[model samples]
Target: MPTYRAPRGTRDLLPTETPTWTRLERLAADLAARYGYRRIETPLFEQTDVFERGIGEVTDVVEKELFRLAPRTEESESWVLRPEPTAGIVRAYVQHGMRTWPQPVKVTQTGPMFRYDRPQAGRYRQFWQFDVEAIGDPGPAVDAEIIELGTRFYREAGLDGVEVLLNSIGDAACRPAYVAELTAYYEPHRVALPAIERGRLDRNVLRLLDSKDPAMAGLNANAPRMTERLCADCAEHFAAVRAHLDALGVGYRLEPGLVRGLDYYTRTAFEFYLVGREGQQQAIGGGGRYDGLVELLGGRPTPAIGFGIGLDRLILALTETAQAVPSEAGPTAVVVGADPDDTIARLRVVTQLRAAGVGSRAELGRRKLGKQLEAAARDGAHFAVILGDELADGNVGLRDLPAGTQKVVALADLAREIERAHAAHRHGGGPD
Candidate 1:
């Protein structure tokens, strides 16, 4: 028998590393809520057609990265491990009639997104995404607000050195013309294009504009710029979005070639990158306006714009910048030295602490007092309540590990004193 590890490209978020994820998720959810976005959870899997139609046929996500599953029984239907939540969320909106309730329904979600990608550094087969989507409104203000929300999320999470690169892909009114021009531009250089670039020339012309191969860079440079070909309405919408961003003091660089790798996106397309990270894969978070996503999923043509911040990549950037900090693990009050004779008394105290919303764990393994304290420290506990033969006599010992302070208090008042200390610590009152 051999010790097995996590499957390649997958990782186990152990206790020590869980705080980072927890803090990031909490910050994202809080920011989303502050922006009037409610939380919505969808299934881990959805119908295969939803992604195929929504993500675009020529995109790499659909053409290569999707995880398709066949039914076990003959009569069962086909399903796919959802590659993204936007399509499923749109499906739910249509199926449940969210359109009738209000205009511009704001929603956010945080979960694992499965993709059959070739696992590499900063890329995983199963990764978590904190996604936020605004449905129904087509106003440029909505786009600006979503981008601002994403900026706030990263700032709050302490992910510095991020830059927002923005662009407008125009709307259906102007995209077709640009496609034709782009196709013609690449026609002459078709022989010089990479295999993937050549394959995408007819089916997905926009992708050719962003090919990473050195040979295709020259061809891309000569291609038409999307901003110049924007329709009147799209041009006005994009101008308004830029104006709003300027008014709010949100810094962004105009990226003419930033037609995000998705079909549903229209008008505004933006990506937030961590500067000085790995080349090309420096994107920590990105999103854009998807005005036709809802309709594609069978709903009314509701407009939406949202972003999914990559938790892993953001943490990696934090690490690279040496800005990563150990998030405060919530207080864990340890009950030490539980004797068999006074087990009931010790259990009662533990239950009381827990009932009061304090995370109190009892020493069930019958370890020595020194070992118990060590265990508490290892578990990131700030304080330990020693309940031995001496303390069992109406008094409890409160050991503050960081301060090297010990005090004896009445058993009835122990929980209150510990809570007050925890509160003060939480409010930045103590040395540690």
Candidate 2:
């Protein structure tokens, strides 16, 4: 026989860790709802072309991280475990004709997404994302609203010291000319660019603007900035987004070199990071404008903006800041000192407690009264109900473990008294 464990880059959230996830989900859901966003669900996998057309061909996700698989049928084409949810959500919107329902469709979802990347601390091959998207709006207010939602989400989740990095990649009209100028600037220093960056020089020159290699970073330091190339329309939109952020009192930094490293994003692109945690590999979450994505995915030209918060990274940030707390665990009630012959009575008590929505556990193995009390304390039980030959005389022993108090109550009034005590204890009104 062999012992098995969860695969690398994956984890099983045990009972002790469930409360963190539960708390985060609740906070995210409440924040999204307050912002007028509804919930949406999509499949875990989709046709390969969906991603190829939706996520850029030159992006790292498509080039290296996608989890590709073939369907069962011989004639069927390949499918991919969705590395992200935006494309799938767009596809659903188009397929369901959601365009006819409203001008801007607001939605959010939380689920597992797969990608084949080297797992490091806070990075995983399979992880959860809390994603929110707004489709069919091209206004700058929409962009600001999405960013605001993301900021509030982090604060609501108890994360502090987070900041936003904002930038505009320019609109379609101004981008081509800027791309040409950028290409020319890098042409002279092309030989100095890193091998990995050189390959993307011609195809995705903007990414070079974000190079981390010391050599490439030096070469790019003098390169022309994207802001210098923004067309009139893109410049106006960028200004409007900034105005909204300022009016709303949201502090942000203008990173001219902030290329989001994604293909579909245009005009507005931004990322959120925790201040003083710059060395952390992953951003807590980020999102930007993807106006052309829906059309590229075979739908109408629907403009949209959204963000995806990495649950793993967010948890890490929370831990580092000492904002996360472990959830308390215990059985609400324990049945103690039941003899083998008194099994029926013990079972009745256990069943009744459960039926009344109380969490109860019983001692099945034969044990002495003292041993039973020790077990109950070890399990963090609130109270112990003793059912033995002594309690067969129409009364039961109710022991309050914490207070060292014990009393005998009529068997008929046992359940009612337990319920009252439990309620009082939960509300902090019970005796010490």
Candidate 3:
């Protein structure tokens, strides 16, 4: 016999871990909705061009991380599981005839994403994210609003001190000259550069600066800062974004060399890192102003900005909060039957209770009544509706685990009785 396993780089999120994910997503959705952002969903797999065109064909995501699928037919273009949600969201924005809607159409989404990257701690091939996009409008104010909103998500999750590392790669007007300067600075030390990084230097020079490679650290640190070379318009936009964040009292550090690897990011690029992660900064989420993305993907010349929050790391950071709080983990009752032949009837009762909006578990075994009751208690079940020969009397035994008490309630009154017992339990009247 062999043990079947979930494919590498993926793991199941079991029932016990779901409450945390739910609470985090609910908070994100509520916060996004409060900002007038509506929920939007896109296909899990899309034409490869959706990402290739949006994020740039040379980027790591498209070059190496993509999980491309074979074309179903010759007429069909290739598809890939979404490595990130932004491209799909933007495609939806264009394909769904959103042009007639209000300007800067704000949308938020949370779902799984696939990336065939090496699995490490806090990184997975299949992961989930909370994504937000402000399409059709571009303003420093909205940029600040998005950054503040990202920070607020952490606060709402009961974790704070998330520091924002922000920078400006400038726009087309200034980035070209800056990239030339960056390339020149690195080209001299090309021998010192790792072969992989040297490849990025000639093509996307800024990517080398964003590298985590130990060898390139010195080259990047000594390179020129794009902030010093920003066009007047970009400079003003950056200033206004900072001013808006200041007005909102959001804290952020200006990192001149910090640039998102994605090519679409323009002017403002930022990442949110856990400041208190034991002195190690781990980015939880980040986004930037991509003013040219909408137009590049065939839409009218529209400006947009958005962010993607990594949910796996987020849940890890907020796990303690979930533990401290009491949540409705599982069902409150288990309909346990004493007779082996009572399985169907027991299940029927379970269904009836559930249909009436009372959640419960079902144990349809002929195990001893005491053993079934003990299992229910171990699961923290508040009630156990024990069915037996006495069920013929139009009554069922309802035992309150906390109170160590039991009562025979009429079948017709079972739902009402369960509600009353649970309410009492909530009101602190049930036994400890």
Candidate 4:
């Protein structure tokens, strides 16, 4: 026999860990609904070109991190597990002709995403995210709305000192000139740059500004800021976004070099970072406007903005901040058989309690009454209904495990008796 464990980059969330995950998912879904965003689910995997075309072939996500699957036959299309949700979501929006339904269709989804990256403290090969997207709207107001949505999620999750870093990377009209100016600024430093940075300088100049290499930091810091080069329309859009944020009482800091990882993103890029932990790896969540993504995915040109909150990093943050992660409450009662042959009677009593709106379970086996009671207590059951010889007399024993007391009640009155005990306990009286 061989002992196997969860694969290198994944871990099983046992009974002890799942309640917190469920709570977070529900919180995200409920908050998104309140904002008028309907739920949308895309497949876990999609046609490879959906990402390659939307995220860009030059990007690391498509070039390196993608978990690409080979085609089953030469005529079959290739596929890959989604490394991010926006591209797939956009694919759905286009495929289903959502543009005809309504303008600026707001939608949200949460699920597992696969990325082939080095697994560290908060990063995982398989992780989960809550995504929100507002499509077919190019106005700055929706941009501000999505940003605030991310901030509110952090606040409601008990996180403190989260700061928003905002930037505008210019749209297609003005971005080429900015990229040209940026390429010129770094021309002299080309020899000093590393192989990867040098390649980025010539291929995707914007990415060099976001590089983590210490050697390129000095050159990147000296590079011209896109905010200074934004065309009139972009500058006005950026200002409007800021005004909306101020009006909503959401504060943010402007970052000149905040071009996000994706190629589809244009204008109004933003990220949520914890104060004193501003590393990219520490970013709680981030997204920006991708006005051209729908067209890139085969739909007519449509404007959209969205964000993804990495839930794995979020859970880690909750633990590190000492915020309480709530656990699932135990059953209200456990029904135990008082005799070896009383299994059927105990099942009936448990079912009756359930019908009366009691959360309950039954202890199976021919164990003695004392053992059964002990098992129920260990399971966090508040009370145990022991079906004894009293069943013939239309009565049974209700034992309060915490109080170490037992009382006899008519079988028909068992549910009412339990309800009253609960009411008494809630009112600060003993469950009698």
Candidate 5:
């Protein structure tokens, strides 16, 4: 027999790594809420059309990466693990009547998204994202705000090397002309086009600008730029977005070649990358304005802007750039030594400390008090509440591991004593 393993494109996040994920998730949720975005969760799988219709049938996620489900029995409509969150968020907005609540409803969600692609470094078949969206607002200020939100989030995570590469992709009002010019530029050299890119040249010309085929670099470079062809309104919107970002002191560079990966993006499209002094170009996250997506999913026409921060790639960059990925906070105290004969009374105090909002752990069995203290130290517990001698006198010995001091605390006042110990630590006296 062979050892079973995680399927291709997937890997386990073991206990040692999960605490970092928890810490990052808590920070992300807090940052999202501080920006006035409420958290919302949607089903992991949605009707396949939610993505196909929302992300467009010709896009890579729909054409190549979607994981469609097989029904247990016939007659159920098809479903797929979500390739992204925005479409499902839009569907939820329409289905739950959140439309009537308020204009520009801002929401955030964090979870796994599945895409069946051949994985590479920092790219997985299953990935997690922290998605933030603001619906029903058309202001360029909102677009800038979304960008600022993402920038500030990375800053909080202690990632100071990220730089924003930005561009305006125009919209239906002006994109048609740019696409026409783009098509004309390629039609003349159609015979020279790579077979994979030829079909999309007509239906999705903008995608050609994003082609990675080294052979087409020349053609893509010469293709008409979207910024030059933007309609009056689109150009003004892009300018305002730029102005607001400058006003906030968020540094960004204009990368006219950046078109982003989605079909719904318009006007403003940007990607955040870890820019090293040696020219590192690892992109951590990106998103853009999708002003037409709401109506496409059955809700009234609404304008929206959002970005999904890739949790996996961000951590990878953290490791690469040597940024700190915080771990879960350590336990406040641990009960040291074997349980007393009156087990219920001794253990009850530990439970009571926990119920009263303290991080507490207990040691079981006849481990020597020495070994028990070692376990408490390994557990990162600040205080070792030793169950010894004083139990008969309704007192326990409290040892401060970091400061190396001890005190006799009344068993009835265990929680308070733990608090006093920490307070002492804060005030410089410590356990001494």
Candidate 6:
């Protein structure tokens, strides 16, 4: 016989960990609903081209991190586990004709996203994300709205002091000239740069600006900034986004080199980082305007913007800060079978109490009353219902675990008595 375990880069979320995951997902869904964003779910896998075309083949996600799958049949299209939701959601929008619904079709989704990258402290190959997208809108107001929504998510999640790093990468109209200037600046020092980064500079010069390579730091710091060369329209859009944030009282820093690692992103770009954790693996979520993605993905020229918060990273950050969702209340009452003959009576009481909205459970393993009560207390049960020979007289023992006190109550009044005790406890009356 051989033992098995979860594969590398993935871990099972056991019972002890799932409650927090559930709370976070619930919070994400609630916030999305409150923000008027409808939920949308795309397939777990999509045509490989959807990503290659949408995220750009030159980007790391496509070139190195995509978990590509083989064609199922000879005629089937190449497929891969979705690395991100935006591409798939946009694909759905195009395939389902969501454009006919309304302008700026806002939608949200939360699920697992796969990436074939090296796993780190907070990064995983198969991790969860809370994604939001506002399609068919080009105005800077929606841009600001998306950014504010991200901020609100963190604030409501009890994460304080998250700062916004904002920038403008300009659109196709003004970005080419800036890229040319940036290329010229870095061309002289090409020999000193790493081979991979040197190739990146030639292919996607903007990425080098946000590179983590310490050697390239000084060189990139002096590179031409797109914000300084933004076309009039882009500059105005950036300023408008800033004004919207200012009016909303959302503070931010202007990071000229903040070109998000996506080819489709244009105009405004932003990322949310813990105040002191900036410049580290502390960026929990970020996205920007993908004005060219729709057209690139076979849809008409539609402007859209969205962001994705890495749930795993977010949770890790929260844990590091000593913040967490409060532990949930456990079973309110446990129905213990004092003897084999009490099984039916115990089950009946458990069902009735549950139907009456009490979180009750029955010990069905034929354990002795003492053992059953011990298990109940370990499970955080507030009270224990002992079923024994008293059933003949329609009576039972209701033991308050926390208070270490037991009382006799009629069988029919067990549920009501439990409710009354709960109310009394809530009102500062000790367990009766």
Q: Is candidate 2 or candidate 3 better by lDDT?
A: 3
Once fitted onto the true fold, the runs of candidate 1 whose alpha carbons sit more than 4 angstroms away are 1-3, 328-332, 338-345, 377-380, 421-428
Q: What is the per-residue lDDT of model 1 for residues 364-414, given as tens digits with 9 covering 90 to 100?
A: 665667887888877778888888666647888888877779898788887
Q: Runs in model 2 with CA error above 4 Å?
A: 1-3, 278-282, 338-341, 429-432
CA RMSD of all predictions: 2.5, 2.2, 2.7, 2.3, 2.8, 2.2
TM-score of each: 0.91, 0.93, 0.91, 0.94, 0.91, 0.95
Top-down TM-score ranking: 6, 4, 2, 1, 3, 5
User: Per-residue CA lDDT of candidate 3, range 242-311, in tens?
Assistant: 9999999999999876878788999999999987575322888989989888888888878889999999
On the 0 to 100 scale, the lDDT of residue 173 in model 4 is 88
Q: List the residue pairs that clash in candidate 6.
A: none
Q: Which has the better lDDT: candidate 1, or candidate 4?
A: 4
Residue 103, candidate 5: Cα error in Å is: 1.2
Q: Candidate 3: which pairs clash?
A: none
Q: Is candidate 1 or candidate 5 better by lDDT?
A: 5
Lowest lDDT sum, 10 consecutive residues, model 3, at: 320-329
Supply candidate 6's per-residue lDDT for 295: 89
List clashing residue pairs in candidate 4. Answer: none
Off by over 4 Å in 3: 1-3, 192-197, 211-222, 276-281, 319-328, 338-340, 388-392, 429-432
**Residue-by-residue lDDT tens digits, candidate 4, 1-432:** 459977778888888778778888999999999999999999999988999999999888888899888788999889999999999999999989999987889999999999888788788889999999999999799999899999999888888888899999999989999999988999987898899888988778988898888887777777889998999999999999999999999999998878788899999899988787755556888999999999988999998999999988888888787674664566888999768567888889999999999889998788888898888988877788988788899998999888889999899999999988866775885432
Residue-pair clashes per prediction, in order, are 0, 0, 0, 0, 0, 0
Per TM-score, the best of the predicted structures is: 6
lDDT of 2 by residue, 69-120 (tens): 9688999988999999899999998899999987799999999999999998
Candidate 2, residue 417: how far the Cα is off, in Å? 2.0
